[model samples]
Target: MTMANASNPFRGIRIGSASGAGLAGWQAETGRSPAVVHKHPVTYRCPLGHETTPVFADLAEEEIPEYWDCPRCGRAGSRRPGTQPGAVGPELYKSHLDYAKERRSPAEAEQVLAWALGQLRRSRGEEPAG
Candidate 1:
């Protein structure tokens, strides 16, 4: 084995076509053609005035997305200039307990807490209070 093969066992193995002409020859022999795709460009502007236009493969007009992410600042960009993402500010943070309270009433929360305490007591081999 050569010094190169000693370092990498796969050094002797060859992968795909080394030349573009080989690929062209294979395509000619197979009689298969590449698929044709239609693409269009869509433009969006972020509130920070960053403009981004990306090519999209959309055969129909309805396939285009309403919003695209701004590549520059990573903000949500709007397809229309007037409907920028910053029109609505970021939502206020809500804790896990706040979300839980929204989903459950006070009585329901009390019942759940009591059940949880009962389960904990049972695991500890103690009788749960009524």
Candidate 2:
């Protein structure tokens, strides 16, 4: 049945109610609303080795489940290990690090490492060395 202005507390959002004269009838007649709906954002990877796209809030519920093949890899669905069908966060970060490593010269690596260490210290609320 179609819910009326359902509020999702976890996501801190509200789903608008479906319109129409027989909104209640439509809810009772069909198990779901004719209007498109969406739930939690589903994480998925684009085939092109690009960063994983965050949950697409604007996509319709039905279309959300449909696989949009990656433009680069031409693979359907986000790459996840084993039966777990979702984007792997660590893999994404590692891939970025690898890309940086490939692009960095020896001196650049040292500079980047120093910058990263400074960032880490700042994140931990520690003062960076001058």
Candidate 3:
């Protein structure tokens, strides 16, 4: 007697189960899904030797964290707490101020003063006179 042919096990198998099928079904039913995004907080240690500071989430790219100082190991970088997206810490304005103070030049001081005046004028919506 002749034996019957066996059927293919995966002949009509679909590519996705319930979870994976949602994307396609939802897209077909609706237009699209909302995009997901995240804002991550960062922490930075002082470049000098002092303390570690937590950077604020709303800070701009150029604003450094408060209380940031690393006198011993001298590491300067932001560390993310979890597996979130991260960005480079802000520039240390205090370090720049200290450097400018140590220079102690009249012309440099005058330049800084002028820059500050210009910034003040701009903030107040006034045109800075040249």
Over the stretch 1-130, how does candidate 2's per-residue lDDT look in tens digits? 4455457634322333544553444464565755664545565655444434545657656665544444455455453422223463223223566788789898999998899999999999999988
TM-score of 1: 0.46
Query: Which candidate wins on TM-score?
Result: 1
Separate clash counts for every candidate: 0, 3, 9
Error of 2 at 40 (Å): 40
lDDT of each: 0.73, 0.56, 0.53
Q: Which lDDT value does model 2 have at 77?
A: 47
- Name the runs in model 3 displaced over 4 angstroms: 1-101
Candidate 3 per-residue C-alpha lDDT over 23-104 given as tens digits, one digit per residue, 9 for 90 to 100? 4444545857555444445555343424455435465666634334344554443343222223454343456667778887
Q: Which stretches of candidate 2 lie over 4 Å from their true place?
A: 1-98
Ranking of models by lDDT: 1, 2, 3
RMSD list, candidates in order: 8.5, 12.5, 17.8
For model 1, where is the 10-residue window of minimal lDDT?
A: 12-21
| Pick by TM-score: 1 or 2, better one | 1
lDDT of 2 at 59: 61
> lDDT winner among the candidates?
1
lDDT of 3 at 53: 52
